[model samples]
Target: MARKTFNAQAHSLCLLVLVIVDAAAARGDVVSANASGEAMAQREFDYFALALQWPGSYCQRTRHCCSSSACCQSNPLAEFTIHGLWPDYNDGHYPSCCRDSDFSIKKISSLMPELQKHWPSLSCGSPSLCHGGKGIRQIFLYLNRNLLRSQFPDEKKHGTCSYPVILDEYSYFSVALDLYFKYNITKILSNEGILASNAETYSVEDIISAIKKAVGALPLLECRRGNGLNGDASSAISWLIVNEPFAPFNVL
Candidate 1:
């Protein structure tokens, strides 16, 4: 299956909570994408796979490198930035924004506090887009128009279709955040003495072992090709899938 990062062009919060961040089984570059076309939208989807992205990889690719992300800029110990929680099909292809709901500032006003705290936009821009008067959502939209091109697309595209069973927009995002908190990759790695360093690349087995040791299962570690700045051909996890051993997390 393809593990996508909740990419951020500039302002929108990039949150890719693709799958489980728990007892995971590490899948390497050999991941099969041979899922049939019918699998793309044949059913309502099995469950969500909340994937996360490495801030360094995300920033470098988007030209917004480290300095912009709070985790990258200040806290060397911060965890991975959220990519998104997608509605996955039984196969590789997943469902996308299927509803007619347009992006409205009012829709997510209630989630602002948590959104701002955990899912803050990593792109650099003036914070005064809100003008004055309870216009935080307005500012958010401004960023969506100018800076955040991908966030809303990912949300509406996937979020719209993830209703009824997943509840609504609020459940979609809140669950992803909850999953993120449940699986702390950085802390998991550190516990096993596997510190993250751009200079060193850990093997898939090693990464999997560390995660399993911490959480008692395997996790999917998705990576991106190197961008020549590092000279290394493969970068560490740009995307991750934490697995659940007991049973797949399906409210269905």
Candidate 2:
């Protein structure tokens, strides 16, 4: 009878020990998950920088415009296109390719029409039937495939890392387009009599002033050596950087 009693107590103790271990393991998993969440939260960028690219300057500087880009004679666009909205550290260094997210056409479906008009792909497989040219499924599929190469990195690297930043993927791209509409540098320069022309070179300081006066804030101006015939002629193209990540972007 004593032996049987001891056996029962041992079986009960074993079951109790198993239950305690399971509870400890569950708590450990929760702790690990919380730590991971905190780490990803810390990965949020310090600031956001919107980089605008001018096709005229790009074609001039490169000396070779892609047949599909805005610089194409068949479809010249005076307005600047979005180069990227980068996540930057205050000191100027930026982070990129931080995470991976599948490129979903549905995510950008609504923006496709506008993107074709404004952010047309620079390089393409079928240049003759570029998205703006043929307007068919072939071109559509091509953009979906090539966006991963040409322009989808923003979502992967910066956008995904931007936790608690904004609404979602749609919001991210839309906000950028909204900012583009608000700051039309071409219009600002024209008002200041600093028009874009290969014939006459405009001073960089004047260009910066034109933008600042319009926006009521300072900007970061970047220049590139033109590959155009007037490469030496003050016809260099300039890029502007406007990202204040710590603060919310008030697109007005």
Candidate 3:
């Protein structure tokens, strides 16, 4: 099979946390196949890819953004937030919606405050759009209600595949939040003088080198042309490979 690759055109800074599978396993030497030649199940994965997005860049590109959106609020986010923590193979093919688990808001209720601050939904549109006289409090209530109804799409898609290791929804989100806080990409860049700016310009090499120096690993850099913006937006993705007999979470 042809190996797949990551090909996302991010508008703002993004981060990908890749957990590489063992060389022997990734090479498919130990993988088992059914008698008909099809792979038994799609649960197996080579690694986990945690994606982080910058609200400033995302909100800037969104045309119909409104106050309902977290980034569009009066106090906007000036930092990188969690996009997703996906389980992916070395070939780039990832397992998603592996099981019939539904995303439940109550499952991770304890983590609501942190999730709201770190992994907020950037999607826009609210009752205020259609109905007038709705205050911010009402709009927030409407949004929260919507969140309860829709649940988290990422949980049903990527989080489900993180079974046995991740265990449950709380664990899955907790792990991601922990990793995001630990890495602190926003602080890392700021420490290297790579602050978000409209007038300043930075070379791609400098950005990558700074992250690599801080994290002690080379990262994949992705950039996109901003709409009527001064410079291109860049995303830095980093990964760590883990072999068998070792827990993937411990490596980070």
Candidate 4:
């Protein structure tokens, strides 16, 4: 899955969060058809902020070679694809936007099966057309959440400096491993709803709503608990991260 960035041509906020910032200006690249148009959505900003802060571990930060040795360089698609698969993987590294670090794998792992159960085809569709490939759901969720937000900021207002919670707590490796295994768990738990050998049954909105509901149900202690069966709050963060993990473009 290719991590998506905000397209100022199509959206409002100019920030590009989680995915690689380098791709924001690159041309001739094959982005999702909906990406350009959707990049302007409202959720883009939230997703973008979270995504931009991803630690070097999952983002392959060292790979980014820039003319100036200032900011970390990266590929949006690579980052998005990798992060979207599992959102709760926070490693104690303050993503650039903020200065903090902590890896919370157990917190993120608990939500994987529910995600898979809700949207089976999430990472299984065509990479270009929003189909399979492992990280597609992660990328798409980020894009979907922020795309519309970016385009219509006036319509839907989100706080500019909302503190990033989940990514700040887990590790990518732990999260991914959980997702891989939990997918099977979802099938076992929601067997009637989940047909064998079929893709996830829920729509993107359904998955998103479930995530929100799950997170809203968490108590302060529960939220802090994080990792390993932490329940809805963990799941909510996972869902948000999966949908929008990139920051708004920071170009002129």
Candidate 5:
């Protein structure tokens, strides 16, 4: 397959990567065959696309800022956050809203802290109501309620399609969290002296090489034109196809 490359224009930063995983292996089950000797393991999707987003770039492009939004918080995030985990096909097509599963905050209560820190919602909510002078307890309640509502769409859309491999909403989110931490892109870039800066500019090859060295694969870069403070740009690593030995698919 021909690998795709996105040129880093004005101010590009690595946003996300679509990592591929074997469905059967992910479920920890051996493939079965029917009476006619046909493989019974029919995969609903080809791979998982783990999309991440840079808070700086997202906030910059967002014109309306709400107090409840992560970008408008007292201490805005300085790191990339989880955007979504989508089930995609190799042919550039995908499925959504596969099943009717209601998202529950209580199921992932333990992960709230990490989710809030790493997967916060960028979209605006009822700022006045979210930040209303209601007591600390009331504010917490409101935020939790909002979180459930915000996360439901994703669970219903993408998470549901993940099916047997991911199981439920908790698993869907937890798996993404695990992958995000396992491949710490920010740390990887910093190690190569590719720190986010307004005055400094980096070569696209250097950025790709740095990530390839760290992750054992080439990453796709994407740049956007916006009213960024210093021509801030973003890059996205297309797809990482994973097999038994966990080798990265050659994108060259």
Candidate 6:
């Protein structure tokens, strides 16, 4: 009888220990699951935060950012009101180049010809349009003329150069940012008494020297690819000229 009681006690203790261990394991599993769920929730919240910070200027006048055909042109107007150079959506339309909710890539590409048509007088020295200089000169003329003097204060300072700033093209499509810097530099030299009004006395080398001096003084020179972002020409130039670590592939 005593032996049987001892064996029964031992069996009961073993069962109790087993039950405790099983319960502990279950608790541990629940804790791990909860932690995973919390982490997922946190990640979702972070995504929402990023989404909230997205630029809201994607809409237009007759509609939201990408609403109308007129507002969403391939090469939209240069005017401040139509172009929307600033952060605020005032006087701006969304470009087809940007990621649009409504506009398609095919549609935007189709508009390039239309863009060339709308502004026929403004040329970038393209053979199809205004017939004039070639290569860099053509590029320079397009950028200088398309940029409105009032919008770009630096440009106003440059006055005008001996070289014809405006070239003949279909319509000025996209002005490069470098052109703005060059224009501003020219203006500063003119103001500083470096440039004489007499074109015969001044040569291209003199103009190049003035530009180099101005660039040396101005720490930031703005350069852009195609039509630039939000008139932040300085940053655009940084990305273009200097090493953009984030975008190694985006050389242009």
> Against the true structure, whose lDDT is highest?
5
Writing each residue's lDDT as its tens digit, candidate 1 over 1-252 gives 433321111221223233442233222211111122111222455556666655554454455543333433554324465666676664677654344333455555676566554554556543321112132234335434433434443554455555545555566667767766777766777787665454444455576677666655455555545453332233233233334531233222
Collision count for each candidate, in order: 30, 4, 0, 69, 7, 11
Q: How well is each residue in 140-232 modelled by candidate 5, as lDDT tens digits?
A: 344445442233345344555677677766777688788788767778778998776655666656767777778876654555544533443
The runs of at least 3 residues in candidate 6 whose Cα sits more than 4 Å from the true structure, single-residue gaps closed, are: 1-183, 192-200, 203-205, 217-252
In the range 1-252, model 2's lDDT, one tens digit per residue, is 211111111001110000000111111111101212222213334555566655555444334544444444574556666666655554545444333233455776788667666555544333221112221223234454533224443334444433335445666677667766666655776788865454555555565566667865544544434443233222222233333432223222
Could you give me the TM-score of model 2 versus the true structure?
0.61
Q: State model 4's lDDT.
A: 0.23
Error of 1 at 171 (Å): 1.5
**With candidate 1 superimposed using the best TM-score fit, by how many Å does residue 233's alpha carbon deviate from the native?**
5.2
Worst 10 residues of 3 by lDDT: 127-136
Worst 10 residues of 5 by lDDT: 128-137
Model 2, runs deviating above 4 Å:
1-42, 60-73, 124-149, 229-252
Better of 1 and 3 by TM-score: 3
Report the number of the highest-TM-score candidate.
5
Cα lDDT tens digits, model 6, 96-170, are: 111101212232243344332331222112222111222223332333343321122211111111011111121
Candidate 4 lDDT over 1-252, as tens digits, reads 422221111111111122112122212212121322232211111122222111222222234433321123332321111122211112321111111123233453554454322222212112232222122234333322322112111101111112232222223323333433432222332333422111232322343333234332111100111122112222112222222223112221
- TM-score of model 5 (CA atoms): 0.72
RMSD of each: 10.6, 24.2, 9.9, 20.3, 9.2, 32.3
lDDT of 2 at 72: 49
Residue 72 lDDT, candidate 3, scale 0-100: 56
Q: Rate the local accuracy (lDDT) of all candidates.
A: 0.47, 0.44, 0.54, 0.23, 0.56, 0.21
lDDT of 6: 0.21
Off by over 4 Å in 4: 1-83, 86-170, 183-186, 196-252
Candidate 1 stretches with Cα past 4 Å from truth are 1-42, 62-77, 102-107, 120-149, 228-252
Query: What value does the lDDT take at residue 101 in candidate 6?
Result: 15
| Model 3, runs deviating above 4 Å | 1-40, 65-68, 102-105, 125-151, 230-252
Each candidate's TM vs. the true structure?
0.60, 0.61, 0.69, 0.18, 0.72, 0.20
